[model samples]
Target: QLEPLPALTPEFLCVLNDVCVKCYTDFAPDELEVSVREHILQDLEGFVRRQFSGARLRLFGSSKNGFGFRQSDLDICMVLDGQDTMDDIDCITIIESLARLLKKHPDLKNILPITTAKVPIVKFYHVRTGLEGDISLYNTLALHNTHLLATYGAFDNRVKILCYVMKVFAKVCDIGDASRGSLSSYAYTLMVLFFLQQRNPPVIPVLQEIYDAQKKPEVLVDGWNVYFYDDLKTLPSRWSEYGGNTESVGELWLGLLRFYTEDFDFREHVICIRQRARLTTFNKQWTSKYIVIEDPFDLNHNLGAGLSRKMTNFIMKAFINGRTVFGTPIKVLSPIYPNQVE
Candidate 1:
C-alpha cells in the first residue's frame, strides 16, 4: 500500500499551478502536432535502421523536459551503437530520405525545414506552423557525456560548467513567485553568453583552438584567488575571486554589457530597483532589491509586488511605449527578454 502525497502550501502551489496552466496553454503541442512529430521521428529512425543497424535515439530540450506547449517543436539526438564509418554523404542520405517522406505531407513539409551538418545533424523547421525538430548522429564516445560537446574534436569543461549552472539557475527562475514572476530560459542563456563574452580577449577563440586540437582545455579564472591545488605538475591550482566593494554585482553586469556587445545600450535596456517589502521569515531580508524587471517594463510602477515608492517614481521616468531592442519590439509579458539572446 502507498501513502497519499502531502498537501502543499496554497501560496506556493497556486503560483506553480498558474505556471503549469500558462505553460500548457501557451505551448503544449496538440494531437496533430504530436502526429507530425512522431512521423518525423519514425521516418528518421527507419532510415537510419536500414542503413546503420543498432542505432538509438535520444530527445532533449522542451520536448523531453515536459515544459513543451501545444505548438512546441521537437529535438532529437541519434546515438550510434557501434563504431561505424559515417561520412557527411551518409548523413545526408539519411536526412534526404526523411525529407522525401515528409514531402508527401504538405502541411508537415511546409512548416519543416531540414538541413544536415558535418556532425550528422539534420535540423527541420516548419515555417508555417512553427514546428521544428533536429536529428543528431553521435558516436558512443561523444554520447557518453552529452552535456559537453566534442566539437571539431575537443572536450571543453566550460561548456559543461556553463550548461549545468544555467540549468540550475533557470530552474530557480521558473518558480514564478508573483514577486519574481519567472526569467525565461532563453533570457538566462543570453545573460550567460554576455558574461562569457566579457572575459578579456573573449572565450570563443580559446574554444576554437581547443576544438581544433580535439582535447579538453583547462580554463583559468583570471582575477581569482587560488583555493585548491588539484595536482602539482600538470595544471595550476584553481582560483576563485570576486569584485571588491566599490563595484557592485550590478556594476559587474553593466561591465559585461559594455565590453562584449557591439550595438546594445545597457542603460536603455536595464533598470535596477531596490524595494522595501515585508519579507517572509524564511527569506534573506526584511527588505530586498531584485532586478525586478528589464527592457520595457519599469521595475517600480508597472510591477505589482514588493514595489517601493522610489521604484514607482523611477519607472515612470525611464519607461515609455514602443521602445525596441535588437529589432524586437518590447512587451512586458514578464521581466525577461522575449526574443533571441544577443
Candidate 2:
C-alpha cells in the first residue's frame, strides 16, 4: 500500500502561483503578433480561393489552440470540397502550384514545397511579420485536435498556464521540436493533460467519457472517431460530481514534473487522456518506443513516435532536474566565488 503524498502549504502554493503567472505572461503571444498572423492567414486564404475555388484554409496547432508562444509557427490545413482520397489527387502538383502562386507575393519568402515528407507540406516565411508557417492539404484531423486542445484550455485556466510553462521549459532545455527527433509542444501539452487527469483528485474529468454519456453526435474523421464534449455550457452539469480541486497552479506544475519523473511508467502504459481508463503498450503495440502519446483523432498516429532513446533520456533528465528545482525550496542567493574576490 502506498502512502498519500504530502500536501502543499498555502505559502508555497502562493510562490508557485506567482512564478506560473509570470512565466505564462512572459511566453504568451502579444496582441499585435496575433493580429498580424491572422491577417497573413486571411491573405493566404484569398490566394487559395483564386486558384482552388470552394476550398477552405483554416488555422490549427498552437496558434489557434491558445497554447502558442510569441514565436510559435502557424500550422494551416487546407480542405477542398469534393476531394475524397489522396490517391485520387496529385498532392505534389497541388503543392507545387501553391508554391509557385505564393512566390509571386513579395511578402512571402522561402516558399518550399516538401512533397516527399510523411505529412507533405508547403513551408513559407512571412517577410512582413517575420513569422513562419506550413500548409498541408486535407489535414482535417488536425483541426479537430486543435478544437479539443482549445476546449481543454477553456475548461480550466490552470491547464493553459501549466502548459505554457512546460512549453517554455522545453524550449529553454532545447527538446521541444519534433522535427529534430524530440517531443512537440502539442505532445508536451498532452503530457500535462494526462498528469492532471490522473491526479489523486483529478483536476478535470475525462472529456470523452462525458461526451459518450450525453450520446452526442459522432464525428468520424479519416475512419477515426473524433467526437468529444466541446460545449462549455453543458460541461458544468457533467462535471458537477467531480467538483473542483483546491490545488494551486504551482502545486499542479510541480506535481506535473514529479509525476512524469517519478511516477509514470513510460515502458508499460500509454499517456492517454481521451478516456478514463488506462491503456497498455501491449494493446497499442507501441512497446518499442520510449514514450507513446496517442493522437485523439488519429488513432494510428503516435505523437511520440519520432522520439529517439537518447532524446528520451535527455528529456527525462530535464524533467528530473525540473522536479528537483520546483518540488523543493529554491536558493535565492549563490555562494561567493573565491577566484572572483577583489
Candidate 3:
C-alpha cells in the first residue's frame, strides 16, 4: 500500500510574505520587452512632466490590465492639470514632441514609428511596430461645460456606477452562460435591438426608412445617416468583415461596454437572426443562420424598411442573459467552454 503524505499546514506568515513580495514585484521585469516598457513609461513621464508640470499621466488599456504580452504597445493618457486651453495647435505640438522623442529610441525607430491623429483629437501609432499610445487633454473647463467629459471625463459617482454596471454585465455575457460571445451581456442585450430593427417593419424608424428606400426608390434616405455594419452582409465572410468580432464575446463585451455604456443604452430594442439561402466566395456558402434585432425607438429609423430576418438572436441573448447566477454575470467565451465567473 502507498503511504499517505502529511497534509500541508497553512503558513500564514509565508503566505503574507509572498503576497507582499508579489505586490512589489508585479511590475518588476527581468526581460527586455518589460524593461523597454518600464523605460519608455518613465522617460515619457519625465519628458511630458517637464513640459507640462502638474500633469498626471495614466496607463490604461491592455498594458494596465496585466494581460498584455511583451509585444503589446504602451497605452497612455495625459491629463493636464490647471488652467490651460486645449487647442489643435497644442495637440499638434505635443504629438510632434513625442514623435521626435520616440524616433530617438532605437527599438522605436527600427519600427519607424510615427505620430498622427484623426484631428480635433490626437492619437499616436508607431508605424513599424503597430504599437499605439493615446493621449487625452482633459481641460477642467471642458469637463464642466461639455459631453466630452461624459464619456470618460473624470472620476465621479455616475462614472463609478456606469463602470460597475458595465463590469457586471460584461461578466455575465462572457461565457456561453449568457451567450457564446464577447459583447457586454448588457450591450449584446442592447445590440439585439439592432437585429430586431433589421426585421420587417424595422422596429426603429431610422432603420425603417433605410429599409423602405432600398425597397422602393421613393422612400427617403439621408447621407447623414451612417451605418457601420450595413455593407457587412455583403462581405465574403460577413462576420469576418468586421474584425472586432474576433474578440471572444466576453472580451468584446467588456471592452465595448466599458467604452460605450455611459453614453448609450438600449432599454427597448429588438434584433433578428437569419440565414442566407445563397452563398458567394466572399459570403459563406453555408446557409448559416444569423441573429438579427432592431430598435423601434431608434430616433433615426434607419436600419432598412423590412423585418425580413428571423428573431433567433433575440431568443438566444434574452433567454441566456436573463439567467441569474447568484445575481452575478456569467460568460461562455467559446461554444465548447463551460460558463465562467466574470
Candidate 4:
C-alpha cells in the first residue's frame, strides 16, 4: 500500500505565503510601466495602419494575460482584415515591409525582421521604455491563448500569483527560455493550470467542459475547436457543482511543485487543460518528446516539442529542487554565526 503524503503544516504555509507575496510584489510590473507599454504599442499600431489599410494590432501573451513580470517582452498580433489565410497575403513580405517601416522610427531600436522563423515576427526594442516586443502577423491563436490565460487568472487570483512566482523561479534557475531548448513562461503557466485542474476539489473547472448541450458556444480557430466558457458572470451558475477550493496560494504553489516533481509522468501523459481528463502521449503521437504539452488551439503544436533530453533533465532537476525547498520543512533561522574575533 502506498503512503499518503504529509500535509503542509500551518507554520510552513505561513512562511511560503510571505515569500510568495514578496515575490509577487517585487516581480509584477507597475501601472506606470503598463501605461507606458500601451502607449508604445498604440504608436506602433498607428504606424502599421499607415501602410497596411484595415490592419489592426492587438496585445497578447503576458502583456494582456496578467502574468507579466517587470521588463518582460510584449507580444503583439497583427490581423489584416481581408486576408482569410496565410496564402492570401504573403506573411514574409508583410513582415519585411513592417520591419522596414518600424526601422524608420527613431524610438524603435534593434529592429530585426525574422520572416523565415517558425512564427515570423518583427522583433524590436522601444527606446523610451527600454522594453522589447515582437509583432507577429495573423497570430489569432495567440490572441485566444491570451484570453484563456486571462480568464484563468481572473477566476482565481492565486493562479496569477503562482504563475508570476513560478516564472521568476524559472528565470532565476535559468530554465524558462524556450529558444534555449526549455519551456516558455506560457508553457509553465499551462503546467500550473493543469496541476490546479487536477487537484482534489480542483481550484478551477475545465472551462471547455462547462456548457449546455443545446447552447454550446462554437469557436473554431485555425481548424481547432477552441471553445470555452469565457463569461465570468455565467461561470458561477454553470459550475455550481464544484464549490470554491479553500486552499491558500502557498498551499497550491507547493502542490504545483510537488505535482510536477513527483506525480506527473512527462513521457506518458499530455498536459491538456481543455478537457477534464487525462490525455495520453501515445494517442497524440507525441511519445518522442521528453515533455509534451498540447497547444490549446493548435492541437499538433507541442509547446515542449523543442525540449531536448538534457534540457528536460535540467528542468526536472529544477523542479526537484523547488519541491525540496517548498514542500519540506526548513529551519527558519540557522544557528547564529559565531561572533567575529576582535
Candidate 5:
C-alpha cells in the first residue's frame, strides 16, 4: 500500500533525533511558567469563591498535562466543595453569573460565557498574563484526562519527547486546530500514546489495563471508569513489559507516521489507548468516520466524530506525506542549540 524506504544512515537518524528533541526543548514550558499557571488558578479560585462560596478551581488541559506552547489556553474546571455534580440549568446560570463577575476583575477582559457548548464555560482573557482562560463547571472528565496524560508523560522521558514531536508535527502540518475543521492537540496526543502502546517493544504500559487484584479496581467519575494504575514507584513490579522499549524519539516519530499511514486501517480499527488490544471501529459502531479515536474515560466521545470527510482526507494525506518525508532521510545540518530553541 506504500513505498518502502532504503536503510537510513546514522547521521540522518541523529538529525531526526535532534529535531524531535528540539520540539520538547523549544516548546515545553519552564518551571516558572508552570508555577504561574498554578498561581492564576489559585487567584481565580479565590475570586470565584467571593460570589459562589466553596468554588474550587483546577488547571487542566495542556497547562497541567506537561504540554506547553506559547498560546495554550488555560482550561480551568470549577466545582463547589460540597457539590458532587452540577445539572445543566445550574451550570448555565453559574456560567452566566461567572462571566458577569469576571467583568468586574481588574486584570481580565473580553469575558464571555458560552453556555451553548457541551461543557458550559465562562471564557476570559487574563490581561496581565496575556493568556486566554476558561472556567467550566463539572468538567470532571477533563481533569482526569489531564491526570492520565501527565502520568504517561512522567513515566518515560521518551513518551514526553515523542508527544511533543507529535504536537509539533501536527502544528506544522496544520491539522491540530479543531476550530478550523481539524483534530485538536489532545486528539493528536492520544494518537501518539496509541502509537507508542502499539509499538513492538511497547514504550509504555497501558495504565488502565494494569491491575493489582483479581479484578480491575473501579473508580467511577461521571459514570465512567476512571481507574488507572498511577503508582509509578512500583510500576515495574506491576507491569510486565516495563523498560522494554528503548527506541530513539526520531525512530518513534517516523514509526508513528508510518503506523497511521501504512499499517493502521483507520476504517476498521479505532485508536484506543485504554487497553492493549485492537479495538475495531465496528465494535464501537463508528464506521461512519475514517479516523475514529475513542476517549480513554468517555466511551461515547469520539474525538474524530466532528471531522468532515474533506478534513479526514487531509489528515490522512498529511500522514502519508509525513511517512515518506521522514522515511527517506537526507543531509544533516547543525543541530539547534538549547538556548536558541525559543
Candidate 6:
C-alpha cells in the first residue's frame, strides 16, 4: 500500500502552481523557432518532389500540437497528390527509396528508413537547424490526433500548463520515449487530457461526445471517425460544464499525479479521452496490458500496448513517487522531480 499524504499547505500549493507555469514558459518554443520548422518542411517538400513529384507534406505531432517544446521533433506526414492511400508493402518500398533520396541531399544526414514501425518513416537530421524529423506516408490519423490535442490545449490555458508539466515529468523519469521502449510524449499528453476530462466538474468536456443531432456526426479518416466539437467560439454554450472547474494549474498537476497513482485502476479501466464514461479493459479485449490507453480515434490502437512488464512497473513507480513528493506539504520542493525534494 502507498503511504498516506500529509495535508497540503497553501504556501506549497502556490509553489506547485509556479513550477507548473514555469514548465510552459521555460520549454515552449517561440514564434521564430516555430517558423523555422515550417521553413524546413517547405524545403523538404521541394526536395522530395524532385523524385516523387506528387509528394505533399504537412507538420503534425508536437510541431502542430499546442504543447510543443523548443527542441521537439518535426513530425511530417506526406501524402501523394492523386493517390489517397498506400498498402504496407507500398509504404515500405517508398520509405526505403525515400531514405536513399534524402541521403543525397546536402543539408540532410542520417537518412534511415524505419520500415518495421507501425507507421513506416524516413528519419532525417536537419544539419542547419539541428532539428530531427521523420516523414511518414499517409499518417492521416495522426493529423487528426494533432488537431484534437491542439483543440484541448487551446480550450484552457491551465490544460496547456499541466500537459507541459506532465511531459517534463515523463521525460525526467525516462518514461516518455516511445522509441526507447516507453510511452511517447503524445501518450503523456493524452493522459493529461483524460485526467482533466475525468476531474470533478470536469475542466474540459469530452470533445468526441458532444454533438448537435440525435446521433454524433461522422468524419472518417483511415476507416475511423475523427469528428469532434471543435467550434471553440461557441463551446461555452455547447458544453454545459464549460468553465465549471477553475482549479489552478499547480493543483491540477498534483491532482493528475494522484489520479494516476491512486485512483486510476490500471487492471480494470482504460485511459480513454473520446468519452466521459469509464471504459473497462475487458470491454476493449485489452486485458493483457496493465496500462491500456485507447487512441481517441483509432479504437484498435492502445498507446500502452508496447510497454513491457518491467517498463509498466517503472512507469507506475515514477507516478507513485511523484504523487508522494507533490502531495506532501513540505517547506521546500524540487522544481521538477522527487529526488531533489529538499
RMSD list, candidates in order: 18.3, 4.2, 18.5, 3.8, 2.9, 2.0
Q: Best by lDDT, which number?
A: 6
**CA shift of 284, model 3, Å:** 34
Q: Give the local distance difference test score of model 4.
A: 0.84
Best to worst by TM-score, what's the order? 6, 5, 4, 2, 1, 3
Q: Which of candidates 4 and 5 is the stronger one according to lDDT?
A: 5
Estimate candidate 2's RMSD in Å: 4.2
Best by TM-score: 6
User: lDDT of candidate 2 vs native?
Assistant: 0.82
Off by over 4 Å in 2: 1-10, 82-85, 212-217, 331-342
Which sections of candidate 6 miss by over 4 Å?
332-342
In order, candidate lDDTs are 0.38, 0.82, 0.36, 0.84, 0.89, 0.92
Q: Which parts of model 5 have CA positions greater than 4 angstroms off?
A: 333-342
Write down the worst ten-residue block by lDDT for model 2: 333-342
lDDT of 4 by residue, 252-301 (tens): 88888888877888888999998878999999999988789988778989
Q: Candidate 3: which stretches are off by over 4 Å?
A: 1-39, 50-55, 65-72, 110-132, 139-342
State the displacement of the C-alpha of residue 276, model 4, in Å, after optimal TM-score superposition: 0.8
Candidate 3 lDDT over 1-342, as tens digits, reads 112222222332233223323322442223665556656667667766765677676555435432233444565656676734556677667666655555554534332223353332234554544565555554222222122112121212222222333333444344212213323222333343332223232222222122313442331122222222233133324332223222222222223322222222222221322221211212322123233222222222212222123334443343344322212333435543325656
Candidates by lDDT, descending order:
6, 5, 4, 2, 1, 3
Candidate 5 total steric clashes: 0
Q: Residue 250, candidate 3: how far off, in angstroms?
A: 10
> Model 5: clashing residue pairs?
none
TM-score to native of every candidate shown:
0.34, 0.91, 0.30, 0.92, 0.96, 0.96
Error of 3 at 327 (Å): 24
TM-score of 3: 0.30
